[model samples]
Target chain A: MAEKDGDENKVAKQDQLPADKTQTVDSTSGTTQDASHEVQQELVPSDARELEVVDVREGAFGVRGTGDTSGYGGLTRPVMMPGAAQPPFGGWFDEVHDRLQTLTDSHDDRVIEKVVVDRGELTFFIRRHALLEVVTHLRNDDALRFEFCSSISGVHFPHESGRELHVVYHLLSMTHRRRIRLEVTCPDDDPHVPSVVSIYPTADWHERETWDFFGIQFDGHPALTRILMPDDWQGHPQRKDYPLGGIPVEYKGGTIPSPEHRRSYS
Target chain B: MTTVNDPYAGTTESTEGPVFTVTGQDWDSVDASVVEGDRIVVNMGPQHPSTHGVLRLVLEIDGETVRDARPGIGYLHTGIEKNMEFRTWTQGVTFCTRMDYVAPFSNEAAYVAAVEKLLEIEDQVPEKAKIIRVLMLELNRISSHLVCIATGGMEIGALTVMTCGFRDRELILDCFEMISGLRMNHAYFRPGGVAQDLPAGAIEKLHSTVRLLKERLPEYAALCNANPIFKGRLKGVGHLDLAGCLALGLSGPVLRATGYDWDLRRTQPYWGYETYDFDVVTWDEPDAYGRFRVRLEEMWQSLRIVEQATERLAVMEGEPVMVADKKIAWPAQLSVGADGQGNSAEHIRHIMGESMEALIHHFKIVTEGFRVPAGQAYAAIEAPRGEIGCHAVSDGGTRPYRVHFRDPSFVNLQGTSVMSEGGMLSDVIVAIASIDPVMGGVDR
Candidate 1:
């Protein structure tokens, strides 16, 4: 987990580079192939050439080391995270991105780490320190009035090393009838992200639920306690490392194995 | 008058005239401190019928006016989202359907939409499937609102409204049972398309359901629209204006009641909802009574959508309802048989005897499920309660990496304090009912 921190900084620094420079790095790396990748490269400016390879997965199923007895024993795939999108994001995305950039550029240039346009949805990877600033601007700004924060979902990626825990906020501009996602990441040891309850009051319970499930502490949240689970429960059950604990089932003739022990493809 | 030696005797003689000790009850054991100094802390539910499904409210009242109201939930948390991580993407519909049990199809539609979006097959989904989805979702909207109005009315001592509301809801459930086999938690909507085509005579049944609900819906308007007692109970109660609603992220009827035409079907327009002819109901009162009227009017609008969908389905007979994708779509063509619902006879014979590759394809798809590309997608649909959104993240695996639902019940419940405070204590029930939160969805 500690070693993952250096890898996180490397990726962050690479993303911080200029778009044209990153394209040169990608071309030299020679990982950009396939028809869809080529089309995407032509469509998006160099910054959104190809998604970042998060993990090089081995085997067809999730299980490793002979637990996977399926015929796809030698299959391997690269799990890619969407890379940053450049200008002319198409439709309202470019406008929102530009407006947000112009408004927040005075405070911190690195606030918006990456802008990803994947599957016709726009996502902004906001810095943890500037999450509140970007969110408030999105909600209150005249051109960018994302007045409604529809959801705040926390996702845990234990394999990602330092930035293992992520929080994704879905904001809907009811006035503009547009939707956008803002994501923030924190290391598991220091899983502290500033709370948005001050801006969007609806985030009160959502932040608590994120804390309860992934143990991502939303700093400055009022009375953050277990909302769904019992107060005495231990460990965040939704984390990737947490076990899906189940007991054997008793039947008329014999007992059956728990769900995790059962024959599963993934 | 009874002897002390007798086991059932109650009276005993004392130094004064006679001292009688009363047991088997705690009528006199009121803790003075709890209700002391004109500030009373009252705990309502975890079991009470009126709290709407195990919702516990801790309210502090100062002489009939509620000073603070805090809603305690999670009595029904089955960790549906967490459990979805272990199941296949197609099987996720079943788990989420049970979240808001009353509005199961809405949950399925929202979840399946997210899955389809993640798979990048949103357009490949059959046109007929989208229509049927719209049909079932509208029908479910009616049923869910019926339950809300029935239970909300019952909580406030309107027995006639409860009976009438449920009486009409049964007709909708009958339509669901005919089409989906099971009435609730049908898991009828698959990721690529629906689980099966409409059963025989499903169109006629749906048409009749719309016709029947159209006639029955007006009875509610007549019953409570102008009734003095009903108005006295709900009017001017739980007043939350448009600003408060926007701030709290309230949606559906609660937000609409604040006079905002913000229905997602009109604003976001998914599943061809833009083509449907209907009106977004709004009430400017911004109170419990306004929410009731909004729900009442929305039911009529849902009926209109259902009517339009049924008319369209009448002509769309014999059309394929599932996606044409061989790898992603479920192989089974379901048909009801003497034994039970299972694979159709022709489909079974084709896979079992006709083609060797077909059998292998069936086994692989059913056992392993198809893999979705590595990505994340969020899909939101306007459910009966509010905006139910599903955020699905896939790690290029068969199973979901993480699935989270922003249940409107859970989010709207946050307004319990803001809505009910500074109002009469009795209006707290009115406030919660107006929100129409299903605790199962709230805790999920």
Candidate 2:
């Protein structure tokens, strides 16, 4: 049956051939005839029904019947059933709560203050000094092998109390496909946190970027330097207090306004 | 030559010639052992090509080997995050698109999705708009990977491959130009819906181009993969295991190359990706070669998706690409003015003669954008390079309280040290290239 389909496909392709390729057409036709001859020798069942061949194009020498429609031309057909809906957020919240409880019981007391589960992810607020201990535990724990550090960013919250800046750590457990966030707060005067690069080497750049942008120093970092800005640049750019610069436009035909330019209402 | 008194040089007041007194009396006793050899400190960048865009690496070297590498960044800082805080919700799309110039569509999609979620308008977005966004993003992914392959080839001394890569990439860019007015920074994917429907002939052109790419991509694979020189340079170089990738928050091709089949499109399924039939290409090699194979295979998968999407688009013809909501989208056709700027005829007339209520609403929305309720949300999408996430905080304001982007290139670039530590200095180039860090994304 497959051999018969191949012969029909060859004939269909040969019908589309350009006029100059006569020799190639003859050779392809010969190959098809040879293939049919070989198939005739292998056939044994006399009771087999003859395979119907449909002439798709009359008088145009095109042979087209239902062949293997699973090849290149048949790829346009949608192949899979519709996917299931997204899992509810409540289950995700429960998992995060469970994980938080496990960490709180296992770790030192008075380190993790509260767990804020929002938008299907959990954020554990740890004291600045207890960050290293928590991260070490998270890394070494067999159940929570958060081997990846993903990102370390600092957010400045001048209006908040005990600490003005919140340093966030996004960690992932590749083994279980789970993610958790660890956040620690430090005062603006002394924005220092223990370096996690010693535990996960990937934190080197993330810490450096955090320091460069938010000015949150990561103590014990092997080589703390700016990873996005020049060393001589003044002020952390991402800090809320840092002033944004304006470029004076001179060659706009009509003067191009800077971002700070305000429109005058008539 | 005259002894010119340069005022700026050595002008600080001190006890004797700028604190030249020695504490240990080394000048009195001439000891050859006391004179230590000088160690040189050289600054590599802010301009060098290898440092990858305004990145300055301060190298402390003793002889040939580097003792320490201190990377300095922020030369390209444009304060985009802060600027987003000032802009209205719908206008934030333009600002986010500039964050990752290579894959602007992904940035736009992420920002739009976050806003849509905040507004609770996810279901309101038209299906045709979602399909259009998916098509644009997949095509953008192909172009972005082409750039990575081309630049990686150039960095590794295969100049011919760069030309081939860019030439193929141009075809995709041509399609982009036809759909979106601009080629690179297309703010075409707006909040609520796309800027407009797919232009005439775009679907047919995409169908043919995707078909051609499906046919021709194997040639690129055969050429680069079959070449022993290319393999020797790339294979086993810059190996970041799954542990390293997960630890560093690496996403996209880098994580997949380490054998993690975690694509947000497949796993999380945003923008109707759940309906698509495609595989997340992965490799267990965890090296530069593995990354290459993964990206190459992903391009093929993207083609498969584009083909399926184009076919689907053919059937869903004449559907509204924009949402019914007029608050977020302008209720007029945007056209290029004589000055080549976007202008709408209805917008001009509405401002002049519209009713007082309509004028006030337009004024407020145009000036302040839409308000997002006070809440915090984290939206993650699979960008061409990796996982691009936007963590937004809104305090019931017309603008975002805080918006942060988790750029994958920034996290992926950190693995460069792990890959290049004990290896030869030349391997650093190949390693960085294989990671395919975009400086715009990294710095942003």
Interface RMSD of each: 1.1, 10.5
Docking quality category of candidate 1 according to DockQ thresholds: medium
The alpha-carbon root-mean-square deviation between model 2 and the true structure, to one decimal in Å, is 24.8
Deviating ranges (above 4 Å) for candidate 2: A1-89, A106-109, A117-121, A137-145, A247-266, B1-46, B49-72, B330-333, B336-341, B346-351, B354-356
How close to the true structure is residue B135 of candidate 1, measured as C-alpha lDDT?
91
Worst 10 residues of 2 chain B by lDDT: B16-25
DockQ for all models, in order?
A: 0.57, 0.16
The fnat of each candidate, in order, is 0.79, 0.42
Please list, in the order the candidates appear, how each scores on TM-score for chain B only: 0.92, 0.86
Clashing pairs in model 2, backbone N/Cα/C closer than 3 A: A148-B246, A148-B247, A149-B247, A150-B248, A150-B249, A228-B73, A228-B74, A229-B73, A229-B74, B252-B386
Residue-level lDDT tens digits of model 2 in B9-106: 23344332332111223333333454345433457666877655665555545565555554555667676777876666767788888888888898
